[model samples]
Each structure stands twice: as structure tokens, then as C-alpha cells.
Target: MRRAWWKEAAVYQIYPRSFCDSNGDGIGDLNGILQKLDYLQELGADVLWLNPVYDSPNVDNGYDIRNYRAILSEFGTMEDFDRLLSEVHRRGMRLVMDLVVNHTSDQHPWFISSRSGRNSPYRDYYIWKDPSPGGGPPNNWGGCFGGPAWSYDAGSGQYYLHLFTPEQPDLNWENPAVREEVYDMMDFWFQKGIDGFRMDVISMISKGGYADGPLRPDGLYGDYTGQCANGPRVHEFLKEMNRRVLSRYDCMTVGENSAVTPELACRYAGFDEGELNMVFHFELVDVDGGETRRWEREHSWKLTDIKRVLTRWQTILDGRAWNTLFWGNHDQPRPVSRFGDDSTEENRVRSAKMLALCLYLMQGTPYIYQGEELGMTNTRFTGIAEINDVQTRNAYWERTERLGVSHEDMMRVVNYISREHARTPMQWTDGANAGFTVGKPWIALNPNYPKINAQRQLGDPDSVYHFYRKLLSVRKKSDTLLYGHYQLLLPDSEEVYTYTRTLGGEQILVVCNFTGKEAAYSLPGGWAGAELLLSNYGNPCSGTALRPFEAFALRHSG
Candidate 1:
């Protein structure tokens, strides 16, 4: 495999609004992030991926961009951004901003001009279609958050496409002018010493236009995945984007690709294709999903299922393309709560470490979400009033009102899997508001902050925080963990997840007990004298009994 800085880097993702609050205006700002540079550097982070802090109306929590070049006032000024960028480089770390070019805020100047009238030159910058013959939406597709995908404009007497909320209108990538404008905005950032970009929903850009989808049982609107995601011209557009701007700079790019197959991923992320460095595929997270989507209340996921999907991606994309390793992000529930044992304090810490070892030891660049290193679990929200994510709130109302799902049932699902669960203020200290903000936080802090806060973990050498540092330190020193060939061990094991990484003559075996039961594991004969590199249990293994949530990485000597 070709070597790159990003390939050896351990990235930490910060959801700025929830990371910290500097001025105490009940919101996190750029200065708050600036103050935490040492905290990230201490945690062994090489790249920091900050979620969108661009100027926006906050309709979708900064995903709807009003100005690509301006920083959000709530996040601080443009000058603050420059200082923050400089500080990150000073610490020998890099910064990657979230690129949300799939859509623009309706209030953006370009969108405003495009929606003015049919004769406007910018009208083609956005997708607009006349009303259907029945005088409703242009198509039967539904917005991802809820409601019709097409919103009617009274002044223009036409409908504009929005895959998300109506306030976020889809940009017309078919328009050469729009593409040029996007490339120019990217150039503005690249010229400023930014490291790279995490392109949001980038695969949805080059659409062949809209079409009616299959009607669901609710009979309201149809699913848009088949018609909208991974559009026909996605690769073509990405290649053009690469040639125009990305190739000029030594930067890393990863695309958020939904509904993408292994073969399709190779086409979009193959190094020779000049598209992107890697793509974040949703298959592993969606393994527990129901017939409609992942938020369904009735769902069950097997450990084997997780292994199958992840192993397929690892094997298929080994040399053809790259892979991205992640469990939690701004848009998903906390990993420990979703995939590990977060029901009790003891189980939470052990299982958190186990999950970390399972993913970090794999062959990919690991992306750690804020508070993840401290084993922060999910929120204990009881009602919709505490929720901030537009998608979660929309799902609650749709499930309870339209589908006749009981309020209790919906709340149960929301508590377990809502995106808001991941958006709660970071647990920085044990003080009020988890020391995230002196004032009332924009979102309520997670109740378990007293035990899971970073201050407490930082002082304990055996804490998950220290374990994460050790993981990064070990990964940095070992080329096998970074660029070795991966092979799944005990591929069909019911309760244990085991894998091996080998490069040159050295090899490392990672064994993870995914359940709470006492399982038996006999090490391979060849690994008889291997040294213990790291373990969550804080002790060397002496028996065949693999205790609940036990995980360790073993390295073989020459």
C-alpha cells in the first residue's frame, strides 16, 4: 500500500457546538476549541475533524450553509478561525473541515437569486420543477427528515428539491457555474492551510433528476434512496472535482457515501481515479436496521452480522480502495450505548475498551468522536423537549402521529438511538454542566458526566483515556497495525471477534470477547510466546477462560 500521512494518522472528530463553551453564551465556540488543543494533542490525535461551523441559520445544526467562506457567529469570527488553524499546525496536528456542498441554505444569496423568478440567471443553480399534474409535489419522494422532498415556492410558482429539510435546498451540480463556485469555495479553504475535508453526502450530488419512488405502507411518501443516493454521475463529478482543486494540494479527502457497494466504493475512492482517499460506508451501522430504517423500535443485531459486513469491506477494499473506521459521529448514537454494554458502570468501561481495541486494530484510519476516548455513554433523555436534532424530532412525530406507534415506544427508540444522544455537551469535568459551559448549555449534558468526565479519567492511568493514548502510541510505532494484511480468525465465532495483522515477518493478533459470558479461547500454537501489547483488564492472560468483555492485542516476536 502507498504511504501517506493520513494513513498513519489517528483522527478525532469534534462536534464544535457540544465540544466546549468559552464565552459562556450557552454555546461552544472556536475559542473553546482553541483551548482544548492541548487536550487533543495529549490524547495522541494527529488530525482533528471539526463538524460544520460555517455560517448558517441553525435550521439543521450548521449543515445548511449560508456562506462557505464565513464562520458562524455562534462559533466565533473569521479571525478566530485563522488563529485556531495556526494553533493546530503549531501543535503538529492537522484540521479537516466538514464540506457540505450537496445543499445550500435557502437564505444563501445564490439560492435567493435562483428562487427570485424564472428569468433570473441563477435560476439554474438550483433544481426547480413545475408542479405535478395533480398539483402536489413534483415527485413522490420524501425528505430524509420528513415531509415532501419538493417544496413549492409561491413567488416562482415552482417546486425546489430538498432531500433534507426544506430550508436546505439541493444544489444543481449539473450547472457548470455551480460546480465552479463550489470549487472556488474549496480553493479558498485550501489556500488558508486547511488539511483536508470530510465531504458530507457527496455521493448524492450528480443526480439525473427526480422520479417517483415505491409507496410505503403508510401511503404518505416513498423512499428516496433508490432514486437519489449514489447517483449516476457521482464518480464523474468527484473526478472533475479532484482534477480542478484537490490534486493541487497535498490533502486528505473522505466522502460520506450512503448506499454504496464495495465495487462502487472502489470506483469512487480508487487512488488512480483521482476521486477521494476513502469513503465512510453505512453498512456496519445499518446492520441492526429494520425494514424501513435504523430508528425502528423493534430491532436485533448479531455480533456475527457486524463481523460479516466489516470483514467484507476490509477484504474487498484492501488494495483497491481505502476504508474509514468509525463507530460514533455527530449523526449517530454513542458507540458504547449502541454496540457495547452501557447498562452498568463496570460493563460500560470494559466494553468501551473492548470495542475500541476491536476497531482501532483493524486496517483503516480510526476516527474517534469527542468524549469517546473517555467512554462517554448515551444520554438519558425522556422526552422530545430535550432533543435538538431535526431528524430525531421529525422521526418521533412521524412514527407516533402518522404510523400509529405509541408515544412510549417511540421514546424508547429515541432514547436508544437518537442523533441527539451524541450531541449532548461534552463531559469535560465534574462541575456544573459537566464543565462544558458555565451558563446553561444549548443541549443538556449527559447525566453520567460525574463518572465519565475527562478530568477524572485524565488522572487515572488505567482509565479509558490512557488506554486510548496507549493504542495510538502503539499504532504509531508498529507498521503492521498501520499497513499490514488483515485476516479474520475464527470467522464464525458466536461470542468472540478475533483478527490478525501481518506485515514483513511480524504479526499481531487482536482478540475481543463481545459478550458478557465466560467464553473459552485457545490461542494458536504459533502465538505461544507472543508478548501482550495492551489489554482492557489490566492484567496478563494466564488461562483459556476469556472473561466478559476481555480484549487484548498480542504481538509475535521474530
Candidate 2:
């Protein structure tokens, strides 16, 4: 086994708009990020993965990039970005900017120029196709945000392909010129001394199906499965980019690959010659939701299913390649709301600890979304109109019209599951806008911030902040947590999820009561009473009962 730089590192994701507001412009800026450098170090993070801040029309927040060369005026000037970068490295931390090259904002100069006319020099930069002879789109390939993926452009008298919202046009990776342009952007960032990038939707770059997926019902096309994902030449482009730019510095490149398998995942981040350091998989995060095609609905989740998914990933990629482990991100609902009890404050922290234990203990790098340290739960909006995310709003309307799902049921599925979940203002203190901004925030602040802000958690030793600090410290300094092998202790237990991590001569056993009731069952495999290393509920006492939601990791006596 070889050591990787990210093995024991903790990553903090910053949704710039919601992190902190320094200019009093009702939005967060680069200076705001600079102000929080010390805070990130305090939270025990080594990497600050800032979401896209490039110029855009706020169509999908900042994911759409109008110009990769210029910082959005709303985020401040390039000097401010330089200052923020300086401040970040000054604190002994690295910065990973979000690389959203898969698609560019329609307002981008290249797209605008390309769409000007068929003979525009930049026209080859994007995908444009003719409609079928009879009429309608060439095929039924649906946009990720609803409607046909192909939108007809009367100016060119052809349909322009967009995998997502109409406002974002997909780059034609099949074109070498487009690939060169993407590489140039990577070089620009690396030259600026930025550490690396968290590439947005990289796998989808190699989409298999085009125009339309083999015909399906509802007057639509096919599902997202390989339809437009993991195209044949994606790795060729990635490898080229890696050689030219990414592989140069000790750069960190993590991709947001939605449905990548273990083998390909390892190939993407494998030890010998991988394209990225790690890639995020949606398996654990979507545990509650059934694994099926986009149009199908399988709502129930099983605990055994949870164990299987986590363990399988561990089993396959243990030492082969690195993995990016996470419970929540800017795109998913809060973990506490998704996996834990969202109704009560006590349960929020309790469940958060357990969820953390599960991911941080695994064989991958842990990514902690902002506000997760405060055990932040979900916020429920009454109507779809209140939601600001384009995907959520579009899905809400489309699902209701197509599936006939009741409002309550529709809300139930997406209540807190959209990117809007982690995009809300970060709760800093119990003040207006949760101390994020002195003025009205660009987005709504989570309501529980009054008690759950970072200010309040920083002082308490038993707070989630401290637990995270302690967890990171242990992972960094302790042998077992860092280089240990994992063993599932009780695979059949219905009420508890337990496992042991061992390295060299040291071993630690972790057990958690996944439900809300006290459980007292014999140690199934006879690995009994060890010193309690850490617990969310109480200390390790073999004879004593396990309280509901009680969690503990105990070390074996030498």
C-alpha cells in the first residue's frame, strides 16, 4: 500500500454565494472567503473546494460559466481572488476551484459567437443538428432539467444540443479545438498557482447516445444511463489534460461522476496512472431512494442495502484506487435530513456523528459540506416557487404534469434533496442572515441557524465542530484510522451497524444503534468489551445497554 496526499486530508466545500458576504452587496465575495481562511483551518480542513465563481447570469447559480478567464464582478476583482489565494496558502491550506467545463453559459463569448450563424468560426465549438424530415427534434433525448435536450435555434435553423438547462449549451468534446480551449483554461488556473480543480460532471462528457436515446414513452427518449455519459474518448481528453496541466503540480482533481462503477472509478483515480485523485459516487447519498432509471420510482431503502453499498465499494477499491467519500455536497440534501432524524435537535447531532463515523472510517477521502459541522438539518419550503434551483423547479413542474404525483408526494421526494439543500446561506452566528451578510442574502438562510451557527458550535467542546476536529486529528495521527483494514463485525444485525478497523497491532471496533430505540443484544461474533475510544451516545460498557442512537468506537487492549 502506498501513501496518498489526500488519504488523511479533510476537504471543505464552499458555495461562495452562501459562505460569507464581505461587501454588504447581499452576496458573498472573494474577500468573504479570505475572511474565513482561519475558520477553515479551525474546522480542520486542508482543501477549500470553492464552487464556480466565474462570470455567469446566475442561471444555475454559478455553475454556468460565461468566461473562465474573468472572475464574476459579483465575486469581486482578480486582485481580490489573488488576495484570497494568498490568504488560503498562508494558512497552509490548498484551494480547489470548481471546473465547470462540461458546459458553458449560453452568454459565453464562444457560445454567443457560435450561435451567431452556421458559418460562425466558433460554430464547431458546440453541437448543432438538423430536425427530422417529418418535424420535431432529431430524437427524444430529454434535457436533464426537463424538456428536449435539443432546443431549436431559428437563427441557424437547427437544434443546439444541451444536456441540461437551455441556458447552458454543452461543449462539443468531439471537436479537438474545444478540447484545446478547455486545456487552455486549465493552464490558466494552474498558472495562477491554484492547487487543482473539482471537475463538474466529467463522466457525462463522453455521452453514448445522441440527439435522442432509443425511443421511449411520454413522448420522451431514454434515461441518463450511458445515454450521454462516459463517452468513448472522455479519458483520452482527461489524460491529455492531466499530462499537459493537472499532472504537473501536486494538483488535486476530483470529478463529480454520478454513476461510475468501481473499475472505471479506480481507473479515474487509480494509483499507478489515474486521471484524478478521486471521484464522487452517489451510491450512499441516494440510499433512501431506489436505484432505478430516471422515470422509475423505488422509494424504500433497506439497512442491509446501505451496508452492502458501502462495503462493496470498500471491498473493490480498498487499496487499488482512492475514492472521494462524502455524505452530502452542494447538490444533495443535508445528511441529517436525508439519513438521520430531522425532527429533533438532539437527534440531529447524534445522527450526524454516526454518518460521519461511517464515511470518515472508510477507505477514502472525506468531503464535509459547509454547515455539516453544525449538524445542520433540512429546510422545508412550502411551495415549488420558493425554491431557486433551476433543476428542482423544473423537475417539480414536469413531474407533477407527467407523473401525476400529488403535491405532498412530490414535495416529499424533493423536499430537501436538491442542490438548494447545501446552497442555502451558511449559518455563522445567530444574527440576521445568520451572520453571513449584513444585508438580505442572495439565498434563504437555514432557519435553525439561530442555535446551530458556527459561532455557537466553536466554543462547545462536545459540539459537532469539536467532534470533527477530534476525528480529523485521529485520522491524521492514529495508525488505524489512516492505514487500517476494515472488517464488518455484524452484517446480519437489524438494529445496529458495526465494524472494526485494524492496522498493525492496533484494532478499534465501532458500533452504532442506527434506530431510535435502546438495544441490548449479545456481541454476535464475540468481539467484546474494549476501551471506548469515542461514542455519540455514551461510554463503552458491555453489561450496560446501548441507548437509541448510541454510537461508540472502542480500542482493543494490548
Candidate 3:
């Protein structure tokens, strides 16, 4: 492996809106994040990726940023950002701010100027296409959030593009002027003594000039790939951005390229020539979504299936671009509830440990979301009125009364798909708003907070938090865990997932029971002499009883 700093690091992602609410504002703020830095260092995270904290209208929460240069007053001031940078560095950690340049809030100064009139010089900063001969949008491209992607303005008599909500107007990366402006913003942040970036919706930067997508079987063509993602000029623009802002700094750059495949993974993170340090894939996260375009369908994700897809990515990208391994993020439901049993305590902890073993031992950087260390589960919202995400509300109305589907039928789907499942405030301790705030939170905390907060888990030796800390320590100290060759063991095991990793003649075997049933498994012939390294499951021998959800990691003599 190359000597890149990112290849050997573990990252933690913080969704600031839910992290902690300082000043009792019910919304997490800069000071709240500052208070958690020590815990982050202790958890063995070297990189911290803070999602958008920029001044925003909050139409889409922090993702729809209105200002690139200023931190939202609600979060904190520029001074707090400076303090955050200093605190991260003081702990020997690197901080990576999210770069959401794919689009800007309609309230942005550039957009305000662009939307002022047809003759405005800033009109070119955004994509504006003339009305069709019939005096309507050029094509039938749909917004990623829903409905048509283009929204017209009476003031300008021209249509602006938005792949998501109308408030978020897509920037015309096709224009050199727009690209330069974005590059300047990158320089400004880097100049602020920040480390690097985690680019949001990165693959969507390039567009196909307002073209339509191919028709689908459902009579609605919802495909957004070739029409927007990885467009023809995207890489050229990134390469130029690198030449101007990124190349000048020895900082890391990761991309939130959800639909990214192995073929293009390396191109985004391939050495000095590539555009990013790594790219995130939602392949694992979407496993339970099944064939539903959204997560409204009942689905069962198999252990074999999950292993198959992830292992293939590891094999394909072994020496290519580094893969980003994550089981949960701000957008997805908590992994323990979604992947393991939420009804029992033993099942949850064991599953969390098993999942940590699987991901941290993989071939790329591991990203642990907030509350993941303590094995937090999902939030239960019984009504649409209780939901916070706009997408959820839109989908509920569209799928229920508008489509005449039963409320019960759709709620089943909402139970699985709503982003609110992950948006609830973090459980810090046993108190009001789960110790996240002294007042009401901007969003509700998962009510299971009393049992899952950090204070309770951090001190317990058998807690999932401790297992993850040990996992991080092992990955840090053992070359095998860091850069070892990986081999799948017991590929055909009905109830267990087992694998081995070896580097510099030090070999470690990892095994786990994937279900709530006790599974019996064995090491290959002549492999019994290995010593136990770090383990949670009670035994290591063949036909050994693996209590439901328990996992094992053993170091064997070569």
C-alpha cells in the first residue's frame, strides 16, 4: 500500500444538528462538539468529518448551506470554528469539513443575484435554460427529492435547475466562472487552517445539459445516473479544483458518492492524479431497502448477501482507491436495530461487536457515526406529524391519501425508511433531551436514551463502547489489522461469518455468529494452534458454541 495518510486512518462523522445543543437552544452547536473531542480521541478516531455547519436556512437542515464563509450563528461564530480546529489538532486529530458544492441554497448571495433578473451577470453562475417551444421546462427530468427537477421564476422568465428541493439550485459546473468561485471557497476554508474535505453528492456535479433519462418499466423514468452523476466534464473540473486549491495542501479529500462502483472508486482516490482520498458507497446501507425505490417495503437482508457484496468490493479495490467502510451515518438508521435484534440486550451488544469486527478489519478507512459506539437503536415515530424530514412528509402524503394506500401499509415502510430514524438528538446521558440540551431539542431524542447514552457505556468494561475501543487499538497497533491480506473463511457456513487477515507473518482469524441462534463452526485443518488475541465470543474451537450474535478474533502461530 502507498504511504497516504488517509489509508491508515479511522474517521468519525458528526451530524452537528444532533450531536449536542449548547446554550440550551435544543440544537447541537460548536461548543457541544468541543466538549466531545476528548471522547473522540479516546475512541481511536484520527479524522473528524463535520457535516455542514455553515449558515443555512435549515430548509434541508445544515445540508442546504446559505453561506460558505460563515458558521451559522445558531451553531457558533467563526471564533468557535477556530477553537474547533485547534481542539482537533491539539488532540493529534485531523478535521475534515464537508464541502457541499454540488448545489447551494437558493438563498445564497450568488443565487439571489442570479435570480434577480435575466440581465444579471450572476445569472450564469447557475444553470438556466430557455423555455421549450411550448413555453415549459425543456424535459421531464425529476428532482431527486420528488416532482420535476426544474422550478421556473416569473421574475426572470427562465427555469433554474434543482436535483433536490427547489430551494437548492444546482450550480452550473459547466461554467468556468462557477468552478472558479467554488475553488476560491475551498481555498478560504483551507486557509482557515482546516485539513481537507468530505465532498457531498460529489458524483452529481457533472450534468448532461438538461437532457432526459431513459424510460423505466413503471412508466416513469426515475434514473438520475448518466444524466447527472459522473457527467462528462466532472473529472476535469475536480482535477482543476485539485490544481488550484487541493493540490496546494497536503490534506485529505473524501467524497459522498453514494452510487459509486469499484470501477470508478479508484479514479476518485487514485494517488496524486485522482480527485479524492476515498469515496463512500451505500451498497451495504441499502441492503434492506430491497427492490423498493424507497424503504417502505418489508425486507430481510441476509448475512451471506452482506458479506458477498462487501467482500467483492474489498477484493476489487484491494489496491485501487481506498474503500470507506461505514455501518451507519447521519442519513441511515442505527445499524444495531436495522441489522441486529433490537428486542434483546444480548443480541444488540453482540451484533454491534460483530459488526465492528467485520468493518474495522476490512481494507479501508472505517467511519463510526455518533452513538454507534454505544450501540444506539432507532427512534420510533408513530405519526407523520412527528416526522422532521421533508422527504418523509412528501412521501407520506404522496403514498397515502394521494395514492389511496392505507396508512398502516405505508407506516410499515416509514418505519424502515424515514431519515428521522437517524436525525433524533444523540443520547448523551440520562436527563432531559438525553443530556443533549437543557431545553427542548431541535429534534426529539430516541426515547431509549436512558439505557444507551455514552455515560453508561463508556465506563462499563463489557459495553460495546469498550469492544470498539479495543478494536481500534488492535487496528492501530497490529500491522495485520492495518494493512493485511484478507481471506474469507467458511464461506459456506450457514450461520456464521468467518475470515482471516495476515500481514508480515502475523495472522489473525475473525469469526462471528450472524443470527440469534447458536451456530457451530470450526477452523480449517491444522489451524487449531492459534492463540486468542481479542475476543468477545466464549470459545474458538470447531463445533464450539457461538452464542447468538457473539464474535471471536484469534491470533494463530504461522
Candidate 4:
């Protein structure tokens, strides 16, 4: 496999709204991030992936862009952004901005012009179609959040497609002018010394036909994934993007490709495909999701299923394309609570370290979400009103009001799968607002922050934060961990997950006990005497039985 700087780097994702606050404004801004650079540097982060900070109406948490070149007033001015970028480079860390060009805010100038009239010059800038025969939406496509995907404009007498909420309209990738506009916007950032972009819902930019998707089993509108994700022309557009904008700069790109499979992933981020450097796939994260929607109840996932999904991605994308290893992101629940044990403080720390060892040891670039290193677990909201995520709110109302489900039952699901779990303020200290702000916080802090704050972990040598630092340090020094071939061992074992990476004469084996019970796992042949490089527990292995949530890496040399 070819070598690149991005392949050897660890990306730290910062949700700017919750990272830190400056000026006691109850909101996190660029200056807030500027204050936290030393903290990220201490965590051994090579790249910082900031979530959207562009001017927006906050309809979808800044994903809806009103001005491509301007910074949000709440996030400080463009000068604040420039100084942040300069400081980041001075510290030898790269900064990548969130590029959300798949759609624009309804208040954006382009969308405002497009909605003026059917004959408007900017009408073709967005996807607009006449209503169907009965004067309904252009088709029965459902919005990703909920409701109809098409929103009608009273004055224009046409429906505009918005795969998300109506406040955000999908851009017309079929129009060359629209594509050029997006590329030009990207160039503006690159010229400002920004490293790269984390493309949002990039696969949905190209659509198949306007035909109605298959009717959902339990909803009024049709499914959108069938006709939207990884559409026919997505590659053509990405390739064009690479040829025109990306190839000209020394930058990195990682696309959030929804509904993507290993087969299609090779085309989007193949080593020689000249598209993106890597892509984030949702297969591993969706393991516990329901058949249709992730919010549905009674969906339980097994450890064996998790192993299968991850091993497939590791083996399939070994040399053809790169992989992005992550347990959760801003849109998903916390990793330790979802995949590991978080019921007790001891189990939380051990399992958090185990998850880090399991993922970062594999052949991929590891992405650490904010507060993940401190073993931040999910937050439980008492009522639906406590939730701030639009998607979760829509799901709660749809289930209770439309589907006749009880509020208590829906809140149970909300506690398990709500995106609000990850949006809680970062626990910097045990003080007011978890030290995220001095003023009233826009959202509530996790009550457990008093025990799991970063101030406590930074002082503890055995804390999850230090374990992650050690893991990254180990990964950075070993070529076997970065460019080695991956192979799964004991794939059918439910209690244990084991894998090995080999390059030339060196090999490293990773063992992770997934459950909270003692698991009997004998080391593979010729590996019993291998040197233990790292372990979550302080003691060396003296028996064949593994402790609860125990994880360790062993290195063998011929």
C-alpha cells in the first residue's frame, strides 16, 4: 500500500458548539477553540476536525450554510478563524473544516433566489420539480428526518427537494454551475490555509430518478435511501471534484457517505481512485439499529455481529481503499455506553481503554470524538422536552402522536439512541456548566460530569485519557500498526475479539474481551511468549482467563 501523511495521523473531532466557551457567552466559538489548542496538543492529536462553523440559522446545527465564505457571528469573526488556523499550524497540527455543500440553508442567497420564481436565474441552482398529478410532493420520498422530502413554495407553485428538513434544500449537482460554485467555495478555504474538508452526506448529492421509492412498511412516505444514497452519478461528480479542486492542493478529504457498502466504498475512496482519501461508513455504527429506523425499540446487537462488520471492512479495504475507525461521532451515542460497559465507573474506564485498543490497532485512521478519551458515557433525558436534537424530537412525536406509542416508551428509546447524548457540554471541570461556560449553557450538562471531568482524568496516570495517549504513541511508532495486513482470529467467538496485523517479519496481536465476564481465550500458537506491549490492567497475564473488559496488545518477532 502507498504511504501518506493522513494514513499515519489520528483525527480528533471537535463539536465546536460543545467543546468550550469564551467570553462567558454560553456558546462555543473560534476563540474558545483557540484557548483549547494546548489541550488537544497534549492529547497527541495530529489533525483537528471541527464541525460546521459557517453562518447558519442553526436549523441542523450549522449544516445548513447561509454563506460559504463568511463565519457565523456566534463563532466569532473570520479573523478569529484565521488566527486559530495559524496557531494550529504553528503547533504542527492540521485543521480540517466541515464542508456541507450537499445542501444550503433555505435562507441562503442561492436558495432565496431559486425560490423567487420558476424562471429565476438561480432556479436551477437547487432541485425543483412540479407537483405530482394530485398536487402533492414531486414524489413520495420521505425526508431523512421525517415527513415529505419535497416542500412546496406558494409563490413559485413548485416543490423543492430537501432530503433533510425543509429549512435545508438539496443542491442541484446536475448543473455544472452549481458544482463550480461549490468548488470555488472549497478553494476559498484552501487559500486561507485550511487543511481540508469533512464532506457531509456527500453520497446523497446525486440522485437516481424521481420515481417514488419503495413504500415504507410503517410510514406514509417512501424510503429515500433507495433513490438517493450512492446514486449513479456520485462517482462522476467526486472524480470531477478531485480533478478540478482537490488534486491541486496538498490536502486530505474524508466523506461521510451514508448507505455505503464495502464494494461501493472502494470506488469512492480507492487508493488510486483519485477521489477522497478515506470515507466514513455507517455499517459498524448501525449494528444495533432497527430494520428501518435506528430509533425503533427492541433492537439489540451482538458482539459477534460487531466483529463481523468491522472485520469485513478491514479485510476488504486492506489495499484497495483506506478505512476510518471510529466507535461513535457527533450524530451517534457514546461508545463506552453503547458498545462497552458504563454502568460502573471502573467498568467504564476499562472498557473505554479496551475499545481504543481494539479500534486503533487495526489498519485504519482512528477518529476520537470529543470527550471520548475521558470515557464520557451517554446522557439520559427525563422527558422529550429536554432533548434539543430535531431528529430525535421528530421521532418522538411521530411515534407517540401518529403511531399511538406511549410517551414513556418513546423516551426509553430516546435515552438509548438520541443524538443529544453526544451533544452535551464537554466536561472540562466539576464546576458550573462543566466549565464549558460561565453563563447559562445552551444545553444541559451530564450530571455525572462531576466524576468524569477532564480535570480529574488528566491527573490520573491510569485514566482513559492517558491510555489513549499511550495507544496513539504506540501506533505512531509502529509500521506494522499503520500499513500492515489485517486478519481476524476466532471470528465466531462471542466473548472475545482478536485480530492480528503483520508486515514483513513483525506481527502484533490484539485481544479484547467484549463482555463483563471472564472469557477463556488461549493465545494463538507460537504467540504465548510474545512481549506484552500494552494492557489496560497493570498486571501481566499469568492465566488463560481474561478479566472483564480486559484488552491488551502483544508483539511477536521472528
Best candidate (score: lDDT): 4
Each prediction's Cα lDDT score?
0.89, 0.80, 0.81, 0.90
Query: How would you encode candidate 4's per-residue C-alpha lDDT over 323-362 as one tens digit per residue?
Result: 9999989999999998898999989999999999999999
Candidate 3 yields a Cα-based lDDT of 0.81
lDDT of 1 by residue, 172-218 (tens): 99899999999999999999999999999998897754844324443
What's model 2's lDDT at 255? 89
TM-scores for the candidates? 0.98, 0.95, 0.96, 0.98
Q: How high is the lDDT of residue 386 in model 2?
A: 76
Instruction: Give the RMSD in angstroms, all C-alphas superposed, for model 4.
Output: 1.3
- Clashing pairs for model 3 are 20-28, 26-442, 296-413, 530-556
Candidates 2 and 3 compared by TM-score, better number: 3
Which lDDT tens digits does candidate 2 get at residues 1-558?
777676767899988988899988889888998888888898789999999999889899988889898999999999999989988888899999999988999999999999999999999899888887766677777777778888899998898878888889989888889888899988898999998899999988876657543455544333554566777777887888888777778888898886788878888887766488888887876666623323233355667777887887877887887777788888788888877776777877878887787678766788999888888878877788779888778878877887787777778767646667777888889988898999888878778889898888888888888888877776777668777888886687767788877888888777777777777755544457566667775565465457767777777745
lDDT of each residue in 1-558, candidate 3, tens digit only = 776677778888899989988789888999999999999999899999998999999888877889999999989999999999998999999999999998999999999999999788889889887777778776667766666777999887888888888999999887889888899999999998888999999889988757442233331224556478878887888888888888899898888885677777778776655577788877887677632367355667777778787888787877666778888887777788887777888878888888888778877888999888888888777888888887777778767765677888777777776767877888889876789999888887788898888888887989988888888888777777777777887776758888888777688888878788887765666567667766766455456577788677888655
